[model samples]
Target: MSTDGKSPLPPMDWPDFQPGWVWLTGAGPGDPGLLTLHGLNALRQADVIVYDALVDERLLGWARTGALIEYAGKRGGKPSPKQRDISLRLVELARSGKRVLRLKGGDPFVFGRGGEEALSLVEAGVPFRIIPGVTAGVGGLAYAGIPVTHRDVNQSVTFLTGHDQNGLAPDRIDWDAIGRGSPVIVMYMAMKHLDQIAAKLIASGRNAAEPVAIVCNASLPDQQVLETTLSRAAADVAASGLTPPALVVVGGVVPLRQALDWRDGLADASVLDAIGRRTRDAG
Candidate 1:
């Protein structure tokens, strides 16, 4: 019998963190709470952790004692490590018999480029496990009270990257088909080319007055949600002085934020101030 306890919970059966293996795990947007148990488990046992720019630095607190933590984050327009070099470094670390954890923000498979790293591991004969985490496209929007899908708003939704490998808006996207078919569009890394994207959508028949929302620093206390129209999104965002690491959502469902925005109560005064500014501008 335990002292003042009804019963002790059974121990969790966690996977062993063996040396000479790499684990590509998602840290989930910016909130440490959103991290998966598997990710936490990996953190506690990792010999070395290579983390991304968007990952919450607080999560590193869970790393076991003496663990080496390396920053491998790549922010756009910043001096960052090349993808090939990063992948090769993982291979090198695994070859050194380290329990390597490549921690990325959001799901490793979604836009996080875990696939490329995984392929490199495969070619180099390094063992690895893929752990998916909550992507900002859905999780970030949820924190902002914007549902990616709604029965009344959209039956289907689309997710796309804002830019391609060349750091420019992707030329291969069929804007006309997407604008016509997708009732809701959630874009990643799109703020840089938002003006062009908005123009393309307008040319493809999407309404200029369609609702749009930009959620920045998603899931973190500093999260900001900016509301605007399709035609005015680029200008409004520019005027507001918001930066990257933001998700752009375009569709009819965006207006529902007026009622569904639950974060307002918990958000800091800056968020309220921004919202107030947007409201006054809209008026």
Candidate 2:
């Protein structure tokens, strides 16, 4: 409220969502609240919202009534719109004088095809802005009550994708190096190849019994976690029947979830089928 009886909704520094342009925004993980202020603002004014599979549908409620909501999510092993086609659609929408907001899950640059889309926009000369959202590794671990880095455990953590563009576990990365040095490893889009990845880690220098936590639909009501060891992770995940859009965390930090789990194992049913030892103290 103001003296003029007007609401100070958006600050003066807020950038207007101009037509004939596009905004590449990260929608964060599965929680609607993880959406950035800029992302919400773009949603309110966007004539077309191109959202992804991991993006919570609840966030779309912020969009102005009658706005066009389009799905362009790329889930592994599922039929998805071609990446090239999706990028061209944004250009087409902007050229047609529509305010386009290309919404993605997690930080657009981190494993999201945002760079490819941004390049497409640049080649086509479409003006655009980038609004970074909370990446899954950060927010997901927070929800699971696992610290990304623990002083007692190790100061270094590694973040990587399980599969490459071709949907195969990345071979170029030196898993041996990561397993030998990295104290904590957070992986995204890894459910499909969890077994192969775990084998690589074991073959590299990581202990077979190293604690591993698989988080499914993190930061959302239906979040499920499987706390197991690196050796049993694949079998436990298979037996538990957890699905994709999940994260696999391997390190001593996995045990921290027992104390930090605020989900309380109640209505949200945050199931934790632990196949490893659990203790209240991190030490």
Lowest lDDT sum, 10 consecutive residues, model 1, at 1-10
Query: RMSD of each candidate?
Result: 5.8, 4.5
The alpha-carbon deviation from the true structure for residue 12 of candidate 2, after best TM-score superposition, in angstroms, is: 4.3
Q: TM-scores across all candidates?
A: 0.90, 0.90
Query: What stretches of model 2 exceed 4 Å from their correct place?
Result: 1-12, 265-283
Best by lDDT: 1
What would the per-residue lDDT of candidate 2 be over residues 1-33, giving only the tens digit for each residue? 111232345555777889999999999987899
What is candidate 1's lDDT per residue for 1-283, written digit by digit as tens? 1112323223677788899999999999889999998898888889999999999999998787789999999999999999999999999999999999999999999999999999999999999999899999999999998889878557899999999998999999999999999989999999999999999999999888878999999999999889989999999999999998999999866765666678885434345445444433332
Model 2 Cα shift for residue 108 (angstroms): 1.0
Candidate 1: C-alpha lDDT: 0.89
lDDT of each: 0.89, 0.86
